[model samples]
Target chain A: MATLELRGVRKTYGTGEVVKGVDLSIKDREFVVFVGPSGCGKSTLLRMIAGLEEISAGELLIDGVRANEIPPDERELAMVFQSYALYPHMTVAGNMGFALKMAGKPKAEIAAKVAQAARILQLEALLDRRPKMLSGGQRQRVAIGRAIVRNPKCFLFDEPLSNLDAALRVQMRTEIAKLHQELEATMVYVTHDQVEAMTMADRIVVLNGGRVEQVGAPLELYRNPASKFVAGFIGSPRMNMLEVAVAGHDGAAVRLTLPGGESLAVPARDALVKTGARVTLGLRPESLNLADDGALRGKVEVVEHLGAEMLVHVRTPQDDLLIIKAPDEARIHPNQTVGIGINPARSCLFGEDGLALILRVDALA
Target chain B: MAGGTKVGGRREGRGWPLLSPAVIVLGIWSVVPLAMTLWYSTRYYNLLDPGRHFFVGLRNYDLLFSDPGSLTAIANSIILVASVLVISLIVGTALALLLNAEFPGRGAARLFAISPFFVMPPVAALIWKNLLLNPLNGLLGWMMGLFGLPVIPWFSTAPMVALIIIVSWEWIPFATLILLTALQSLDSSQIEAARMDGAGPLARLRYIILPHLGRPVAIVVMMETIFLLSIFAEILTTTSGGPGDATTTLTFLVYIRALLDFNVGGASAAGVLAIVLANIVGLFLMRSVARSLNR
Candidate 1:
């Protein structure tokens, strides 16, 4: 096991900077995922860490040693590319044993190691077949087997499951999680899918436009996002954001007028909020419930009947759209008026600067 | 229903009528000449004595097999094609790898490297014969003089070697162009994976790049063999099968017999022999090299 640290790592292509001063410390045996939208510099950062791309300006430390000038092979890291990158000409066993052969290991030793890795990946039957002869899932296992034979200090996955179909991606996702548990190696994975990040990552680093937006545990990022960007990004169906104007602030809480002219009290200190100031109110879909005596009113525009739950799209009188998660059996229909109830404790408040304001303890309770 | 069936039969008959133009052109261009050649090869025909012709079954073939010059021509043809293929493939692979790397002026350099392939065969032969390898005052002779070395006569002394060098120079660009295109299509991530697997440059080249290039290289060999067997203009323009028939290949021998000696029967027999040889080589290459690639 090894700890990986990136100190102010930067990458620039010609004049355009792609990865801007990303600083992170990954602990031993930790599964850290870099998650973001397309062109968010998450892949670039991962490549830099893999030594596939040069580190433009900062130090990459592996086990407290600077490894900026180290070649990828010498860096003691194995990367699983999205394309799988298996040697098409060689058999599965040959591909797995290639590194050992290149390092001048004896034939018997290489074969033994390859056999062990095949046993681990359940690829013993495929050892004699070439990559072109294998299915997509088998090729993926061969790719992992190739990495397993190396026994590197850390494993880097560059969106490894992006090419698989939906069902297979889910199956392989669990398999990878199990592999991590078995190997217990420090793994760094990059993907644009937040669900993968939420499901597989021990800690998730959310990136946007060449910069890290927030880095925290998946649930921590889901529960307490640092900015409006993260709040909208971390959760499925997206967190509903409504523009609000502060009506007034009491000594312990701030009273805000929603877009539909309804007022609610949010637990925010007076110093962090001001009277007549504008802010965005963040609420997850699950945080909003349907109540008979709720104050806020909206018309249901659409109803999505998922098997386990129902997603109700509501349009308020202020013309703002909000999604509410309801039970599958909930009787919701389009063109019907409904009340949306918000729990103040599960809500977040973003100031004019887009930074999350401190929520008072009473509201969190 | 009878009228409709008649009309459909008429329409079906129209297909051959429409296709007759291409068929007629191919018959005149290919089949008629081949038939004429086949007829002439079985007879004793001489352009110099057209009225004294007679059928001579297998006599011309027997004469060709018995002629010592025919054996030399066959050997020279095999040597020329094999040497050029070997030299071009090796140099072309190296040049393709060099051009594949990231460097300034790479585009212009690639264009320059492939420029020789576009040069006319006769023009390339003449340029090498007169300006490059002429023993008296050629550039190579001048370089030899500068080094105080003997300025040996290239074409006169080493005609086969000179022919091989000139042909390889012209054909290397073709091999390089095809191989370079194949090299460019290689997935970069595969190379990166190999590198991450602790493969150095040599190992990567051996295990990845060469294997990826297998099909294209086979194609290059097949195409080059087809063209290399019929190499005529260069031999005609430069050596002319001189120096005691040292550089006389099968096609050159055919030209000498048909055009110079006017021996129609003998030339036709040799032409048929060349076709048989080419087909045998082509079949072997397809079965051995191309099939192994499985492209």
Candidate 2:
């Protein structure tokens, strides 16, 4: 295993800079995942590390040696692409042993290694079948097997499970995580799906607009996102933001009036702003519930029941449509008035510039 | 489905009647001539002796097969087809590979490489014979004189070789275009995988690229075989059944037998035999080269 370091890595096309100065150090055997939205330089950084794309400026060190000038073949790293990219003409055994064969391994040795790998992957029965004859999951396994046979120092995965159906994606994602544990190899995976990043990564690197926003443990980012972008991008159904103005100010606590003119106490003590300064209160859907005698009031626009849970969409008097997760038995109907109590301890606050406000949360008494 | 099939069949049948005039004309022009040739191939009638003839039981074929002139023609035909196929596949595939690479002025280079295929065969041969490879007056001859070397006879002693060059000039362009198209469709990811697997350029070519090209290579062989076997104009213009009959291919041999030897029946027999041989070769190539069936 090798510790990979991308030192001041920058990528540009023509005159436009895409990945602007990204510096990341992936420890050996670390399952680091680069997570981002589309056009965010996650895949671009992965390609640079794989040597598929040229590093316009900066150094890549693998195991403490410069690897910028080296071609992908000599990098001692394997990649599993989104398309699988299996050699269609070859049998499963041949596909697995191709790298060994190319390395001039003896026929007997190649045979032995291929068999061992097949047994490991539980693909012994399919050794003679071509990739086209295999199912989507089988093909993906073969793609993994092809890389596994090489025994590279590291593995780079570019949205490897993106092509599978939703159910299969979860299954394959677990398999890949187990494979990483069994192999104990350094892997830097790239994906736009935060679920994949959260579930599979030892450390998740959230990138946006060609820059690293934050890198931390899955729960670390979930519990305390450093910025508004990271906070909104990490969770499903997304976080709701209501524009608010500070009505009254305390030392560490501020009384803010939400868009509906309903006041709530928020913890935000950085860059002391005058009264009436605008801000956005970040509230996750999961934190809102139909509590008795709640303060924020709105009319129920729609309620979406997903068998296990219900999603209540309430439009407040200020025209701020908010969605809150409710229990399956909760009664919510269209055009009916609804009030939601957001768990103040779990919500976040941000200034007008989208910088998350760190605070010791307390209510203004 | 039944109604759709019935309507399609009725429409096709109606279209057939519409095509009757062209079909009838082609039958009279082509089919009747082919039938006449078949009839003539089995007869003993010569053009000088009118229509009366006895049915020859493969006597003319035996005579033609046993003759030295016709044997020389058969040998030259085989040599010419072999030499043309080998040279074209090698040169065309090389040119195609070079064209497939990223280089400056690649579009111009490709157009230049396939230009000879569009040139008329007679003009190509004449250009080669007079100014390119001619012993006394060609470009090579002139270059040799610049080096103060004696001019060597290229067309006479090595007329078969010269014929090969001219025919390859015509066929290589077609082969190169087909190979280029095939090469372009090959996925770059597989190549990268092979490379990441530590496969050098040659190993990648041998294991991955060559196996991938099975279908296209088969196509090249089949197409080139059909076109090269019937080489006539190049042999006619350059060699003219040449000194010692070194370049008299099957088609040219058939031509001379009818025109010069005044043997219509024998020529028609040779023509029928050539066609049968081509069909047999076509079938053989098709049978051996299986489909790739790649996903």
Residue ranges of candidate 1 with Cα displaced over 4 Å: A250-252, A268-271, A359-365, B1-24
Per-residue alpha-carbon lDDT of candidate 2 for residues B51-135, written as tens digits (9 for 90 to 100) = 6787886877887788788777767777888888889888888888889999999999999998998898889989998889988
Could you say which candidate leads in lDDT? Answer: 1
Model 2 misses residue B235 by how many Å?
1.2
- The DockQ value obtained for model 1 is 0.82
Model 2, A1-365: lDDT tens digits are 99999888999999998899888899999999999999998888998888889999989999999999999988999999888888878899999999998788999999998887787778999999989899998899888888888889999999999889999999999999999999999998999999999999999999999999998888777766778999889988788888888787877677888776678886656535568888778888988888756768899888899988988888988888888987876567799987789776667777877877654333221
- What is candidate 1's lDDT per residue for B1-295, written digit by digit as tens? 9999999899878888888899899889999878888888889999999898999999999999999999999999999999999999999999999999999999999999999999999999999999999998699999999999999799899999999989999999999999999999999999999999889999999999999989888989999999999999999999899888999999999999999999999999999889889999999998868575774
RMSD from true fold, candidate 1: 3.2
Tens-place lDDT per residue, model 1, A238-319, is 9999999989887767788988787988765553777888999998999888886665789999999998999999999989
TM-score of 1: 0.95
Chain A TM-scores, all candidates? 0.96, 0.94
Model 1's CAPRI class is: high
lDDT of each: 0.92, 0.85
When summed lDDT is taken over every stretch of 10 residues in candidate 1 chain A, the lowest stretch is A356-365
